[model samples]
Target: MQRYPMTPAGHLALEEELKHLKTVERPRITQAIAEAREHGDLKENAEYHAAREQQGLSEARIRDIEAKLGGAQVIDVATLPKDGRVVFGVTVVIENIDTEEQQRYTIVGEDEADFKINKISINSPIARGLIGKSEGDEAKIQTPRGEVEYEIVEVIYGE
Candidate 1:
């Protein structure tokens, strides 16, 4: 498996989720399964079926998180020298050239990307276009809607 880049915070988040799944959810589901089984009639027991399904989904998520953590190369942006360039875990402010709308986004790992929180995945088109760019640089992104241009206004490293 190829190792991929992840911010230190993103890596920690995944580890925390894995820990919760293994230590809390796993045991809770096991108890639920036992209770459902004790009710008898495994084939017709709706609770038993639901509990088993939940167990499968939870286990799958746990495995996925584990694999990602194992292959993660955690990077701490704060330790890196500030060069005013866009990099992983750096929050960037950009202004849309056409609408003059400004937005702030932090480039992060795929697993940690949440558009609602303004965290974009490094592999995303916008992030890819912004990488290696410094403040005052223009970046052209190929979005699903169409091509959009943005001017870098700031590059922030620390939280």
Candidate 2:
């Protein structure tokens, strides 16, 4: 089994979503299916077909969440030593060598990556470049645009 590295927050979020799907969405979809079944002929009933399709999608999502949770290895960054090295679950501050633009990004699992919130996936180009590097180190990252150099200013854990 392939182990997925995840932060404590990401694991909890997935668990919450799974619970919501089972408790709320599953019941709602079942009710919709039941109500649709009352509308006479099943062959030509669009509502019934749509309800079934929705149930299929919801069930698939639930299974996916469960599988992810099963394979997840939650890593608590707080327990790790603060050695100033960029690693998974750490919030890293990097400054662009060219423009001097500084950005803070939290390295997280693939499922928890939200670029708008500055949570980057560990598999991402920038995060891959920053990982294992120490503070004050210059990292040259390969992005979609081209190569970019950044200075690692800080590495914070549990932030």
Candidate 3:
């Protein structure tokens, strides 16, 4: 099976979610199903149907988390070489070549990417352009709008 590249923080986050799903959600859904079963006939019990559907969804999420965790190759940024090159689990500061607008983003796995937090997926166009590039290097990315060029201002590891 193909292994997934992920930061240690992302791995921990996934593990925590899996724990919550299996420990809290699984038991809670089981109890709801049981309670709904006691309410009335199985044929037309809305509560029972809802509970079952919820159970199915919860179980599916649990399985998905488990699979992701199992396939994960956790990389701790702190252990990286800190060679000033952009890579997974590192924060890269870049400036738009044309607009001169500066921005900071952390290169992360797909599941760990949150634009609000300035974390972009490794597969993103910007990250793909930035990867293997050191500070002071210029990267050209193909975006939906068009090709955008960025100058790498800095590369920080373990941030």
Candidate 4:
């Protein structure tokens, strides 16, 4: 099994979600299905159909989460090297060459990518461009909005 990188926090989050799904969602859906089955003719029972659909979806999600958690290689960001290179688990500050705006990004695993948190997936174009780059280096990334240029301002390990 190929192990993918994940932060410690990300691993914990997935574990919690998996626990909730298996304990709470699975039992609730099972109960719903049982109750629906008691309502008579199965052929025309909307409740039964809905409950079955929900059960299928929930089970699929549970399996997916389980697989991800199984293959996760959790890394603690604070333990990363203090080198100025932008790498996984490092927080990078980049200045847009054109707009002159600064933005901070942390390169993380696929499951931990959240735009709201400014965490980008390692496979993302921007993150790919930023990876292996040192402070004062420039990275050109192709975005949906076209090519954007950014100069690496700083790189912080762990914190």
- In terms of lDDT, model 4 sits at 0.91
Tens-digit lDDT track of model 3 for 112-138? 999998999998888999999999999
> Model 1: how far is 15 from its true place, Å?
1.3
Per-residue lDDT tens digits for candidate 4, residues 21-140, read 989999999999999999999999999999999999999999888898889988886877777888888889999999999999988888889989899998899899999999999999
lDDT for position 61 in model 1:
99
TM-score of 4: 0.95
- What are the per-residue Cα lDDT tens digits for candidate 1 across 51-157? 99999999999989988988998989999889999998899999999999999999999999999999999999999999999999999999899999999999999
By how many angstroms RMSD does model 1 differ from the true structure? 1.1
lDDT of 2 by residue, 53-123 (tens): 99999999998888888899999999999999999999999999999999999999988999999999999
- Against the reference, the lDDT scores of all candidates come to 0.94, 0.94, 0.92, 0.91
Model 2 earns a TM-score of 0.96
Clashes of each: 0, 0, 0, 0
Q: Clash pairs of candidate 2?
A: none
Task: For each candidate, give its TM-score against the true structure.
Answer: 0.95, 0.96, 0.94, 0.95
RMSD of each: 1.1, 1.0, 1.2, 1.1
Off by over 4 Å in 4: none
